[model samples]
Target: MTRTTGYEPLFTLKPVAPEIWVVDGPILKFYGLPFPTRMVVVRLTDGGLWLHSPIQMDDGLLQALAALGPVQHLMAPNWIHYAFVPDWQRAFPKAQTWAAPGVQERAGSRGLALRVDHQITDHAPDAWAGQVDQLVVPGSPVHREAVFFHRASKTLILTDLIENFEAANLPVWLIPLAWAAGTLDPDGKAPIDMRQTFRKGREAARGAIETMLSWEPERLIMAHGRWYETGAMAELNRAFRWVLR
Candidate 1:
């Protein structure tokens, strides 16, 4: 399918692959500076929507998504990406909320009551099996990220594992920190904190990274920045190269 339109609307709803739509949300103050967020909506073979790393869901956005398919699954891809989960759950009452390991605990810690219907494991659930593959990326004790592979689209969906921020879209003061995090655009890499996470549990992290690499994904969808179209696998390998080495 066609990649982005080179421009992201207020809630950019664009198709990155078959049965997958990404919505770029508003800029929020992150680390005391403006930062953007994104979410992916996947229409399963059964015509149910699986939300990955959800963003702020407004009436307009909800209407747009409903037109595509019934919201069936709201997924918290990682501990750090569950902020807007309660909002989505309220919108789609019938949808089953899936939590990545440690997500429920983390949400509770923040006093944000979460509705986790099921916990996502390394194996793909019955609702999405054969169509989508999943793996729980280990090593980050602070954030356990559940990565997904859409078999029909050969696309890998990641949350915060790799962050790419365009310097022009950020405040001048945030640029240096972004660069230090290895998240600056055109040279997107794993965030510094995540790299340290891997260092703590390198062996386990390596196993998880190898599982992701084995998928040989053709495209990638990220939560904080632009997704990768071509050479997705290469970009992925590069992002976690330190651990890979």
Candidate 2:
């Protein structure tokens, strides 16, 4: 983890795979849970940039992103991850913002005005012409929870679906929950919360997992936990066994 000091809240940039970076900020403690939040950056073939679940933008981070390339697309893969879109849009006015289906409606309920250039659907892969692959992980009240795979880097990007936090970092009360949920590394298994989340739409979630597994990605980049560098598909299978069960 490359740490950035002198910032009010420190942010770390870690490269999960080639041309794929995971930017992690301070721990967000809410709902009696402390989880590391992250954002992903992918460099596209056309010299354009695609950001997945952008973290809170500061002048430093914004300048760092601008130096990389012109951001052409900003994606909010799930409704819960929409908090930073407005700030990102304001920073990169030229970029086209995208939200998953029903995101705008959900955002409105939260008193947020999300101006999306496009709403993501199953056909989005075809629309982007294989530039990115998106799979909707069905479950949880939070709709539009799509997992993304960037073709250029063969990196599967996820948010909230599979978390792999180290046990030492968690509070004592949370440790048991993390252990029960299979979130504790190195053999981090999918937690009970994730299973419960999947129970609501087992069929749809299974289908989405099956579709994503077919990609045979070598690396898995996650938003709230440690990324998998090798045998990513196998890890994914192990984490989401509730679908198979």
Candidate 3:
């Protein structure tokens, strides 16, 4: 199965911890879209599958997932990340849909019908029964963020919280902005918009960051930037220092 349309797959299977795989694509350069957003695939204990943040579905990606096992669960970590849910649900109709709290209402406002099998809350960790650990990053209505950790991989997965851009992929005009925002390299800069978004709940946001940092992830996967393999927890702490203060 190969659905090659809007974008080509530039697959990088990051060994964040162990069984977890971080699949991502080439960066969408023109508009500061660094890396084709990442999607986390977890191999469940039952040999079933659980997917977090389903990227745009293509036959190729779909086939790749099928090879893993039965995709029993599809999740929308937050409101802004639901664009590809319809296609994924169509592809795996038997898969149960899960959404972060408020996601259904948000989807309804967007005129997208969502069949959510469950809604994630602060207690999602217990609800998920150690299969996955979820935390609510309190900030941004558009984001209403949910961060995930795959116990099998010891990997922490996040969307939009940290974006690390590749210099070559950025347009000349956006390069300076990217550099300043900390998307360029090891300096650990948060994107300007991300900075603004984090300001909404300084204390709450910091607490969330602290909670994730406490997990001590071996690798960090971001939706819009490069994935960090080493010292990921340190990088995350550096990038979010502003919120800490």
Candidate 4:
């Protein structure tokens, strides 16, 4: 059970964009089923790093991240992804933690005293200004995913919005379940149950998608499964086809 954060087998760290890096976290059980998790790192204009959806940080990983830049910001893209915020906050005491709406309340409910210093809205913060553009995909009551675009690298970063899990990568029994949910590879999409929840806020969700498309991103960095390096915009439109229709 050493899949998620806290008890890590160590996360693999690598560079994904010009100044952005990633730590591929260990697979954790989602509803008793295995699921992959990822954490993204972006270097801000002021020579500090902005961490998105931070994963388990071991000594080695911390050292590696330090080599990239000063860790100045820690972001929780959604409520469900805030579990690791406390760990990162303690590790980087000076870093500001940005919350994605409901995260503060959810963290409190889970008995975790998370320090979320700022809220992530449509406006890009001064630290990441000119480098990253942000959008909040509003729909589900319990979650609101914050998506970011790296202007320099033409990369779009997302969490839980567009998931494309390869069938071979999943446990045998879970393959059918993922496939039925429209989360399987070759044409990865968001979870069907999650999409159904958009009925009440479909317009807001569409607005977010439109904003993402406006960026004309060349690559996509997802928090789950494989990422898209080419034709990213096309894939985004395809993944959110239901919302668009």
Which candidate has the highest lDDT of all?
Answer: 4
- Residues 12-110, candidate 3: write the lDDT tens digits: 444445567767754333343444567788887777777888876666667777777888888898776777788889888998888887788888998
Angstrom error of the Cα, residue 88, model 1: value is: 1.3
* Tens-place lDDT digits, model 2, residues 1-245: 63221222444455666666777766666465776778888777676778898887766776776677788888888776788898888878888888877788888998997789987766564335677788677655544477888776777888767778876666678778777777887756555665676667788787888888888888888766667778888888887776766
- Local lDDT at 68 for model 4: 74
Clashes of 2: 3
TM-score of 4: 0.94
The TM-score of candidate 3 is 0.83
- Report residue 179 deviation for candidate 4 (angstroms): 0.8
Worst 10 residues of 2 by lDDT: 2-11
Candidate lDDT scores, in order, read: 0.84, 0.74, 0.71, 0.84
lDDT of 4 at 154: 93
Q: Judged by TM-score relative to the true structure, which candidate is superior, 2 or 3?
A: 2
Off by over 4 Å in 1: 1-7
* Residue pairs whose backbone atoms clash in candidate 4: none
RMSD of model 1 against the true structure? 3.8
How many clashes (backbone atoms < 3 Å, residues ≥3 apart in a chain or on different chains) does model 4 have?
0
Cα lDDT tens digits, model 1, 1-245, are 42232336746568988899888887656556555778888999899999898887778887888788899999898888888889878877899999899999988998999989999999998999998899888877776889999888889999888888877676678789989989998778778877887677888988998988899999988987767877888888888787788
